[model samples]
Target: MAANESADGSLRAPEDFRSSTCGDTKSLKKSHLACRGAVAIAAISLITAIILSSILFAIWGAAREEDPTFQNKQTENLQQCQKQCEDLKMMLHLATQDSRCRLCPEGWLWWRRHCYFFSVGLQENRRWKESAEFCQEHNSSLVEIKDDAEMDFLQGVMCNATKFPFLWVGLTDSQQEGRWLWLSGKDIQDHLPLVVQWDSDDRDCADLRGDGTLFAADCEEYGPWACKRES
Candidate 1:
């Protein structure tokens, strides 16, 4: 028998036996390479998972360390905001009280540092002298215009108030012709003379027209009036 033949007397070819042994060897090598590749992949995956878990744990640890400080800062800011709001509320309450104490009386208009009353809706028209008495009854006086500013304010008020022809003011030349004087006994300054349209007739009293013009009217003429007093 040849060295490659089976012991039972069956003949075996050397070429065929060699071919089968080479095929089995190649399959074993392929299986070993596949198993090595799978092991390498599993190792890489495990390493990646460990690295990610370590990063996550580090971030969580740092956040935990800062949590109390962040919470305290937030609470401090909230408390400051609440304190500021309380201060503003207190200031507003005090200001309201102060304003109420200084407010003008009912039926009176406050301007600058004085209170004023317009007689448009109060009573029937009165003569210039009667108008002065009516203002006295209210503990006020016929409005004594201090400057052009006061005159302008009064004119604006009259312009917006009513359609009455004119309102009596505290100005007159009844004591002497050609010599005008305010109710306060201050001589009408020549420099302060506004566009006074004097009457051709012998008129003494001055009235404010809705057009903001001053007209010399007779003292006996009946008209509404304005009064003024300190606030």
Candidate 2:
């Protein structure tokens, strides 16, 4: 008979006693007021806690739901920053190192103290051996990627070129079957620390892709090749 409904649709019992003598009535009224005050404070605190928690959860959820385009833009920015850093390091190197340090020849790219020239606009693309000969004519050799940095650079640059998909490097297994060699006549395994991850273990020629990966190609594929020299 002394129940009350709270705003949250919960039933609660009033702390006031109905059966009280006149002398005890004032004390009961005082107790009732104190209990009501405590209940009000508790209700306000619970509602405040729920509101704060809801806001925090909404913020966390939105943070986790990142926009795909925004993520792509962030990736592009990171790549550009990396490229700028590399360029700065190259400038400092040219400033501090031997005077012989210089810009790559026309149509060439400079990376890690090496000059790379990607062949293009030829009357016709040459065979693997002829491509090597072309590099030899320039006092360089068909490019041999030496590290991950070099691989990434070559892949990125090629991706921007008008002509691409595959390009040649100074790698072959001509003299002996299954034993690879660089154009420099050194055993491929001995000269390069990384393994030649061939598309198949049976092919001889080496080709680089715009995606910065390697695959074995037919020795006579008509495509541009890269040349490399010390800078």
Per-residue C-alpha lDDT of model 2 across residues 108-209, encoded as one tens digit per residue: 677887778776543246677777876776557898776678878888877787676678898777667666677767776664464555535457788777
Best-fitting candidate, measured by lDDT? 1
**Model 2 TM-score on a 0 to 1 scale:** 0.49
How does candidate 1 score on lDDT?
0.65
